[model samples]
Target: MGVGVFGRNHARVYQELERQGEAVRLVGVVDSDLDRADAVAREFGCRAFGSIEQMLTTHSEVRAASVAAPTVHHLEVARALMQKGVDVLIEKPLAASLAEADELVQLAATHKRIAQAGHLERFNPAVRATIPLLTQPMFFEVHRLSVFTPRSLDVDVVLDLMIHDLDIVLSFANSPVKEVRAVGLPILSGKVDIANVRLEFESGCVANFTASRVSTERVRKLRFFQPQQYVSVDYGRQEVLVFTVGGDGATSGAPTVNPQIKVAKPTVTSEEPLHAELKSFLQAVRQRSTPVVPLEDGRRSLALALDIVAAIREHGKKVGLAGLAKAKS
Candidate 1:
């Protein structure tokens, strides 16, 4: 409902869908700030409202809406929408706390509303192609870094950035986390700006993740090793590369770099992830089915992110960072 950075993208995609002949319409834009709402609505050629109630009242034809408010307000906004029979796509990190996440999950169920979580990476073409190739991922190494921006400083690097990789790794691992070890520092923001985490899963899978918002360059890539093969995914490029070990039995599919190694790249139908995500959400809404990324999935990812944050805090305390942050603040 809010027309901030990410919210504007949602509105843009909806408007694009209308122009592309999709059975969808961008009814209106809503924000607590009336001026911002009016600006975005004027840009999109739609009406503007100062609150969800106003938008819902003015645009009764809106069957679905995106809850793009900040994390703390997710439950409040989504709950209001679901209660009024409007399906919602809530932005990631689901909520500021697990209790709030659980409440939204229950509320969605209670209202029988089609609720989805905005885990945009799940819609990436590379990730979609790699899903079927998964056999048994043993280890993962992921890096997501970006130059510092004032936006989303409400959350640490783990929630703001690494949660995308966390959701992917969790899906691939398909097991509960057994242990978490993490370390992070506040370089540019009060929240952790750079973090490194190691997660051990019950299935004996290990994942190491590094996320930074204070970087000189931008990077978004993930590489994982499994039995007899290794797979690499480039989120920015929307590509997947598979390196397989060849046995003496066969080698007819891909080019062989050596007698025992074959490298293959899966064909990726490149599309903007956010566009694909919103399209998928609409499809789910029309079909009355579960979305590719559901509320439970968001909650699971949030749980892991919160645990990693807790680990970071505990580690920081052991090293006197708690006092350091307090003193600085």
Candidate 2:
């Protein structure tokens, strides 16, 4: 079942798959908006529930669910579904707070249900290709700046955009965070719409991240400096450029360090990451296999994002205006 506002996409994708006789089917939908529920139901020829309880009660064959509600509702919906012995795949940011995310993780464990988080970038072919080249990354930088959109006006840029980079960074290491420095500003919106974060890891890895929703052009890029090699990833263009430091075509047998050279600029085909993400979620449920991005992973990412937000808020003290209330004022 697809629950809540943005979840309509989930139902549509399922219906498309069923049209092609795919393994998944559009069993039901649950949305807070009655008109939307009814319209979507008519389009897909599926039942529309006013609440998750009504959906679960009516669809006994619904062994799995995809939770696409707002970030705040993620925990509530996921916990309820897991309690009903249904595997759940939740959208990004996991939950509004880490504490709530942790509760969902615990619920999944107690109920023994497969719980996955929607960090769809994992399915991006560019990201998948860069994963192997990320070995021994000493320095990483990510920037996700896009033209302002009101679709996610409830929160700031960190959770809205940078969480993708945060999730991707964590996958590269097992080291704990040593320190974090951040700052944010609210230009047009009541909340912080742009932010920058610098993270230092215990293993000497450093990552600089920036996100903004008030940009003239859309950009999604990540650059990594791993040892003597440098890799630049342009996710939006689905292209990767790598540079490495090694010996040149010289007869000087002194093994002298050579200038950096451009490595293969691999061409990555463009594909919809969300479709692959949902497909994997269904496959995981069917095979009883571990989720590619598990609930615990979501919990950890939310925890880090919360920590970054706190640091940015505290960062105001450095500029002598400690309590600048921009949002919820």
Candidate 3:
């Protein structure tokens, strides 16, 4: 709805879909900033509105819409749309708080709306390919780092960056979290800019996640081990490599273990995750079915991220980081 950075991309993709003869259409763009909205509308060849109410009032044909506004405005925007009988695709970290997330879930149910969560990584080909190979995952090591960016500093790294991995791991573990240990620091922002988290699941699965917005390099990768097998996924590369034990692993051309290990790469059709996500959302809208990533899934990830944030706070308090934070500020 809001034509900010991410919202603009959403508009662009919707426009692309229209050009491709999809059953969807990009009716208009909405932003509180008139100039920004007008600019995006001009770029996408659509009308601009100052608010969601204005858009809905003018364009009643908009059966579905995307809520790409900031995290804080998710509930208000999505609720307004759902109230007006429009399905919506809300951006990640479903809401700022669990109560708001619950409100969204209830609103969707009450309105009979097809609500989708914009967990972009779920559509990543690498992640999709790694799904079927899942077993009793015992351990995980994940790293997501990026150079310092001023965007998304409104939230901590746990929500802004690490939540993607959190959702994926939670789905893989398929068990309740037993314990959480986390520590983070505000490197270049008031909120936690870098974090390390350890999660233990009830099924004896342990996962370690490290996320940073202040880093020298950019890396997005997840590796896990289960039952004498290890799988690695590179989100950026859209690639997956699996290592299986007790096989003819002597093939030296691929990513493999020793002679006793076998390496295989699942077939992954590379495509931009955002495009895939939007296409899937539109398909769900047309079919009147559930989305791949629903509001409940988003809430699950949000709850875990919130827990890690709480753990970070507890660790900070124990280490006397409050004074350090105050002094730094």
Candidate 4:
């Protein structure tokens, strides 16, 4: 795997897995910035390429790629790799638009190679713990707020931060979104840095989500309520709080006892999900099995994200937010 854009982190993760006798190796590092390239390559004892073309031309053993390039460059770079028979695990949001995502998905299908999305939350232990519990969610609520970070300004909060929640919500419901409503404004940044969205799903599940890159504190959580219980999960803290009826007569109608709250600390192991995700992709390639987060899933998330962005724009117009600054003000 070639570390693209500060992708030495990918190299580190893979090397750590290799140290554990896992099936991953550090092939090389690639960067348009020669200095960054040389620095990371020297540290990893691997070759460095200033361009994807050079990497493809020079390294024949490079079978797969983890695309950590910027969003705008994702489609172009990943498509080229796919054309060359290299599977790609692209960073989240897939691409800037649904159209681009579609193209990449088709290319992967055409080539019969892997095209996985880096929605690392799919592998998150917190999410994995909650997946089985979310059988029939009546209502879902998510909050993903962080003290303003300098990363991911190429797009707004919807695409940058909120899409993670959106993807998770969609995955749980496994239903089509019926309607979307959103409000966003550029605060602290010259783009839509913060936003709130509501999504209506056909399965009678409604989701309210709020995301902001401008905040004093950080929080990543999701809450879901059903007929029998309410679940509050702190994804940031890896904590789950389940309030539900207990005892044999619990489901006998008369609300048996207080809601049982279980705090299941999942044996804090050093199993990084991103590393697991990357390993899964590699294993899929080696086994010719399906990737956990396939390209189609990424496409669906991108499509919904674009709809939310459009809804926010419409909200802007409704409130007479004709200018970006006015919306923020």
How does each model score on TM-score?
A: 0.95, 0.91, 0.94, 0.92
User: Candidate 2, after superposition: displacement of residue 24 in Å?
Assistant: 1.0
CA lDDT of each prediction against the hidden true structure: 0.91, 0.81, 0.91, 0.81
**lDDT tens digits by residue: candidate 1, 87-197:** 999999899999999999999899999999999999999999999999999999999999998989878899999999999999889999999999899987888989999
RMSD of each: 3.1, 2.8, 3.7, 2.7
What is the Cα-based TM-score of model 3? 0.94
Worst 10 residues of 2 by lDDT: 320-329
Model 2, 1-329: lDDT tens per residue? 44445577778777777786778778788877767788888888898888888987788878888888777788888888888899998999898876788788889889988889999888888888887776698898899999987768787778888889999888875688889999888766767788899999999999999999999989999998886688998878878888876665323435555554658777687877777787888889989999999988887887888888778777765675434343421
Estimate, for each residue in 1-329, the C-alpha lDDT of model 4 and write its tens digit: 33544377777776777788987777677777877778887876777788888887888778888888888888988888888998888888889887889898899999988779888888877788887777688799899999986876778888888889888888988889998988888887777888888888888789999999998889999999886778887877766777775656556766556655444444333457777787888899899888999988888988888888778877888887756424321
In model 1, the Cα lDDT at residue 326 comes to 47
Clashing pairs in 3: none
What is the C-alpha local distance difference test score of candidate 1?
0.91
The lDDT-based order of candidates, best leading, equals 3, 1, 2, 4
Better of 2 and 4 by TM-score: 4
CA error at residue 33 for candidate 3, angstroms: 0.8
Preferred candidate (TM-score higher): 1 or 4: 1
Per-residue error at 70 for model 1, in Å? 1.0
Worst 10 residues of 1 by lDDT: 320-329
How many clashes would you count in candidate 3?
A: 0
Q: lDDT (0-100) at residue 191 of candidate 1?
A: 86
